[model samples]
Target: MAERSTADLALTLTRASRTPLPVQVADGIRALIMSGALAPGDALPSTRFLAQRLSVSRGTIVAAFDQLISEGALLASQGRPTTVHPSLPAHLLQQVSAAAPDPTAASTRRPASPGASTAAAPGRPDPVPAPAPASAPAVDLRPGLPRTTRIGDAAWRSAWRRAAAAPEAETGGLTGLPDLRAGIAEHLRLMRGLPTDPAALLVTAGSRDGLELILHALAATRGTLSIGVETPGYPGLRRVPQVLGHRIVPLGVDGNGLRVDALPTGAAAPDAVIVTPSHQYPLGGSLSLDRRLALLEWARNEDALIIEDDFNSELRYTGAPLPPLSAIDPHGRTVLLGTFSRLLSPDLAVGFVRPTGAALLAELRDVREVLGVRVSATTQHAVAHLLADGTVRRHTRTERLRLGRRREALLAAMLDVPGVRVLPMHGGSDAVIRFDTAGSHRGRAGADPEARAVAACADAGITVGRLSAAWGAESQAAPVDPSPAAAVGGVGGAGIVLGLARPADGAFSAMLPRLASALATVHHTR
Candidate 1:
């Protein structure tokens, strides 16, 4: 056979179609084989070369090849490029060619009458009708969720297979599987630039579980400690300390994240401060260098600890990511909370807590021993494999590209809408759309434009985040212009938060127009 480049195989991809890329590629190849464009025994291009030529992930090409191989259309060996099955019967190819319908002719065909017979001709097998396309699921614009369809790729299955085959460990232990802990440590060092000892890392179900464990450990030793949380912050994190009977201090936040200068001093200082410095929740602001330094200084002077929720910092679309708070802390007073919920899938329920201080680490270990391990041994093993084989990093890169495009689509859709502004951010899974109500009667009456926006989105079958939910009870109660022109805590004005991670690429694009229309309606209303 003559040598042929992958360019010989002409494949067109429809980016706007709801069909997944891998399936599209596979179907394209199958059609080529059935049509005799690729003859039996013909060699195909390497997956790496094909992936680059097609501008898709390598895993996508691998999946397409795997699908074809399973159906006896392609053959692959350990070290050779894939090829069309040499032993494929010529009669089978002819049959497939004869059965394939002409799309153009089908498009122009008239519908049969109600009384028309639908049976195949005598001595012919009846053709099976194609299944109807499934309706798209509801669009969820609430933050923190990610596109999970990509997680079920070959790497994911392979990870689980390895885990199932491995000998079951005697125990997951107080801190989780040793191999998983080591994997997490290396991950943090490479991704977040935070050097961590495997011993200092404790695996938890997620950020919430890690926070609960920390609170319990601290309460057991120090009694009811005051936990400082960012106002208009993650309600889930705030609720953890509140439910544990600890005092919740509402800290002020600006565009640069938490206001370190405004931190209470003397008798009112908090015992620990929980913050999302990488990308502030709801607002999507990075903590300034000056504030980071001041926060560390405040923690030292007050003898407090910093619980850093390094949330969604890795999904940044533009610019370099700032170093995590734990990476720069000088006093060893920071406890870093990391999770795969946003990077991978929330269903994985895997996260890690790493403290810089020796005493704090020891205390957390002791507390975990009493509480026992919350994650299953199999889960830990699977996650450890993902981390070890670079699957997590590759997946993160793919997701970042996907989310960046979604963010751009959102910004473009909302750009022309009157009285709406999309906040600027380096990276995050969600965007804040501020509704401008300046000089309007609703603005003067404290009409809560954010609430109205949320209602409008809900009515359109889209669930979105409300900025008001981020505020503490007291902040929500304070009298002020609910719809101000200036950004509040850097988030600016009343707006709805849209999660960019939940929808499929095609569904997300389709959703943009509806979202814009809903927000426009809310803006023009009295």
Candidate 2:
């Protein structure tokens, strides 16, 4: 039981492997525990010290620990030092022995034919369609994406000009050129009704990066995390916590938003929660004031941190932009993430996360410094100008009206189509359509993944997404149910996202009728 930091302890855990750093770290630790190189009751290293020694993000270290915990290989105590759980070895043995043989596995060595393994018939809806070629897009009706085709020549040139002219940011001040943060702060203040202090703003490469940064800060001070998420939420939201080793508790959502009453009570609930209150991702339901108050109460009681990722606040076709959850967070628990990707363009990749306050921001800033820089000051500056000149803001407003019209067009077009059922979202870019026959896109083998099923739709030049990954599974331990085709309306859907903002305007034209026809086909047969 040495007093050394986690980094020093990780020295004993290093192995040369092609696996991800997080996985390798987990494997190394797994080997030590399995071999009894580290004894029960022995203390594990601190995450920071280990990350410092291994030269990886604390997030990466957290991911390692998350995996071990998931496999019943490690246990962590809150606020106290991490230790080797007494029964870890015995449990690890049980886990190792109980693993099912994957016939699809590259190294399928089991005696039984892998195909013979019937996964106790998936009780969930029949699995959905196959994946569309990432590059193949005729009329992209895929949802959750934004139109970025309006970055005018004048604004584009000006942004580049500012970026070209701005000097490297000083080593001491918060990221980006001086004017960029100022511009963004002012814009958020005026447009979003957010009183953002320039000093508190830290620009990031993207909203995803911003999430990573906030989660990194939260993980360092806690152990055994449970972060809350919506039931039918963005799959991408779960990745950050899963990677950080936090258990995601599925919070039910209705007309309002995340049901605060469903949050785990006592000391067992999550230390943080990520939400899209402005407009719930995928579901598109905005959190009402009552729910917001309830969420704030839960956060106060649970002492939880709220991560507000408000990407599409500006694109609301209906109603005023509600006050961000972060703005009303009295305890400074909310960390707001604002991204230019959807508002301006996906390629902009500029995002700013306002931390709880200066103190937390400083701690996170140090963490970023330790990771050898996670963002670019240059792009940050360019985005700052876009906000200052009203180019990004004006374009976002204009696009909101445009997307609003398109939403109506797509909705109206699909009104008469058969078998295609879309749940209406109050305001969002994509639709979620439930298809009758499970399409071939679901890579899940147990379900009927016959190519003929997918070809039936493909022949009509329509594409769709399999719902397994998009929707929640029974548990984090379980993959999404592989049944009844759920042709996702986002990214890859039969109804194409129809982004008039892309370089490819002709793509949507081809997709519209096919979507209408597919709907008609599904309805007529029904």
Candidate 3:
């Protein structure tokens, strides 16, 4: 039995409007709650009482209450009166009350034209939305994370339900469940134009997992091999190798991506090289066809391997994505590492590796199982369901449109900001912005412009990835003049990686001015 409030609320319902009666009722209640007419702990009328007053079915009232409860607008409990959610922050309540119209004066107030509302009244000042909370972090633009808001509620629920229904160990194996591997293979073939056999695919947790597994397999065969990693690239890639006790050879990436010619020849050459050919990490540049062929040629000649990180290749907005390096490697020297992090979310941790052969696949599985490194069986099943049901494909389309819009917004906002160079993005989840502060401040404290910009962004609560930090320890150890103007990797100086897709809806546009202001700080003060 639930208690009911005696207070009566004024609500207007129109049968002529396209909006449903239940929705109208919910909106009316929400307005009252937001406008301070209904305070926290104030009881909501019982469904029966409200239904009788509004002349609607009890079911309709229930539906309205349920909607409000789902949105945290109202709180409901067993054997207790339904009331406004008390846990809501005071600032939010204040914001709503400030924005909402006066309920007592509603009947006396005359409707104003849309244009009229845009301007402040002659005697009364226009109501402005409350400022965002001071504690909230500014829009995070660090690369790698993706936006998952576009995933439809129905599709998400269906995937999770299917996952929940399936028994954990029933369908999973060491290299991931057979169904999931097959699903990944099919997805690759259809979306990436990479014809992969399920037998050759080994599902790992993510790109790092796949890389570690490959390193294990490589170590078993080659024994303590030296690996070439892209300099001023993903530090995790370098760190993962170091953890495995493999010697890291720092390789540089230019406008085209990892420089193949920079690799040592003969005895000094690394046994294998890891490259992000399909939109390089941190810096969003795709490997050129000539370089791809050259890389494959190098691998074939040295009898070495090329671990291709096909990260965010599927999210290319402009033209068709270039064929993956693995696709071009006819000698079976290329191994592809991919993940669902950008497609879906990082929490899935669902990634796969297309090994060079069955031998490598078997070795990877053995290493993974022996080391007890396995993704949750439930997550694998959910991802597999998404792939098989074409939910991922539909979601990818929506994500691409969203990413494109955000990228455009970021570029447009930074266009006028001094000393901030927006690099061209071929196709990837992130964009790079180089900072050039020449004559601002040249002292020891303000030597590196990239460092200054990163600190400024941090102070402003904007989380952005620094390009200089991406360099391997070995790369950073290289001799330099210690001058800020010393250009590295063809760029004038260092930059920051912006994950455009990470911002919430309507957040990117709102934070653009703040971002510009932050960049200006570094641009002007050295």
- Largest lDDT belongs to which candidate? 1
Q: How do all models score by TM-score?
A: 0.71, 0.65, 0.70
Q: Write model 2 residue lDDT over 257-341, tens digit each, in one string.
A: 5556666777555667778887775646777777887887887676677788885776666644566776556666677888777
lDDT by residue (tens digit), candidate 1, 276-333: 9878887887777778888988987877778999888777656434567776665677
Better of 1 and 3 by TM-score: 1
Give candidate 2 regions above 4 Å deviation. Answer: 1-137, 169-174, 435-457, 474-510, 524-526
Which residues of candidate 3, in runs, are more than 4 Å off? 1-137, 148-150, 167-169, 476-492
Relative to the true structure, candidate 1 reaches a TM of: 0.71
Q: What TM-score does prediction 3 earn?
A: 0.70
Q: Write model 3 residue lDDT over 453-483, tens digit each, in one string.
A: 6767766667777776666446743233333
Instruction: State which candidate has the highest TM-score.
Output: 1
Give the root-mean-square deviation of each candidate in angstroms: 21.9, 22.3, 23.7
- The candidate with the higher lDDT, 1 or 3, is 1
Model 2: ten consecutive residues of lowest lDDT: 108-117
